[model samples]
Target: MSELLHLGALVPAAVGVGTLLAMRRDAGRADVLAAVLMLVGMTDAMTLSFVPPVVWFAALIAAGLALAAGRRFSPVATARPGTMVSTHLALGVISTAALILLMPAMPSSTPALVAPSHEHGAGSTMPQLVGAGLALSTVALAVVALRAERSWVHRLHHTTMAASTVAMCAIVAI
Candidate 1:
């Protein structure tokens, strides 16, 4: 079931990538890059357990920082009316990294009614809360993108990214 959910999450992200690439002449390089990064992050979430969690976390953090730096330093980013897309992508990457870092600390399963020993202790609650918060924030960003973006393609891409983020969170945090 979990695997199915993870794969389901990838669909929207793949759509977003396809949407961006299909309109490559209209989309900015930054936009395409952001969509690809989002796709990569979602893919990583699905296959995260294959390697050490720290490695994934570190890579995500570095990617996030690079995105941030690019947004901050790039003349094109500064010239744009709003840097919302770049900011959103950077936050998504960092949030994914944070969630991945917290995954090992989270309970593998929900506590059973008859098995109190299965209950997650207080230590696990923080990660859960953080994951929920990130998920909510991504949803909020999606709403904002729908309202703020002028282009239909951008709106679709942002919405898909948000859905992917929420799905990834559900897979890792739940």
Candidate 2:
């Protein structure tokens, strides 16, 4: 499960890098935001102590990028308002959730919040809630995009992203 989780974390990073490559000549707010997300995912996939700081930095940058993208592709100005808003918002949500997941576990002597045994570790409930929230947000974004977008490419991308987010969320929860 841990190995699968690590693999799942790479999916977004790969997609983000691919999108950045595709926009080589004409990169925009979306591309830049995707790059930030890629960095976040890549850092999170690692099991190093330094990962926490890197993920925090990436999450901060991604959050800023999400704001910029949201402004650049405002719903009123963009033809695919749903897609534009949902995509950036989803990125922001996932990034924030990643930050929460990296939070340190409390001491073993502490009482368990939801488990009878101390096996699960501390700060578990918050991460699980955040993971579930991320999954739901991603799924909702995909649905909104599927309903609003006319392009097959975009539809496929949204579906793929939603699936990846679901798996990543499940991994985080576990």
TM-score of each: 0.74, 0.61
**lDDT score, candidate 2, position 147:** 85
lDDT, residue 164, model 1: 71
Q: Per-prediction count of colliding residue pairs?
A: 0, 0
| Position 87, candidate 2: lDDT | 49
Q: Model 1, range 1-174, lDDT digits (tens) per residue? A: 677767767898798788667654444576567667656755654563443456667877888788778767763522336526666667777887776666533234333311222346757677677878998998898788678777777677788778777777777666
Runs in model 2 with CA error above 4 Å? 20-30, 44-49, 53-58, 61-86, 89-100, 103-124
Residue 151's lDDT in candidate 2: 61
Put down candidate 2 lDDT per residue, 1-174, tens digits, no spaces.
755665665566466445434433333455456555545544443344333434454565566566555656653333333344344444644554464344333223233331122345684587678777777877786787678767655555566566666766666566
Q: Which candidate is the best by lDDT?
A: 1
Candidate 1 residues lying further than 4 Å off, grouped into runs, are 22-38, 75-80, 104-123
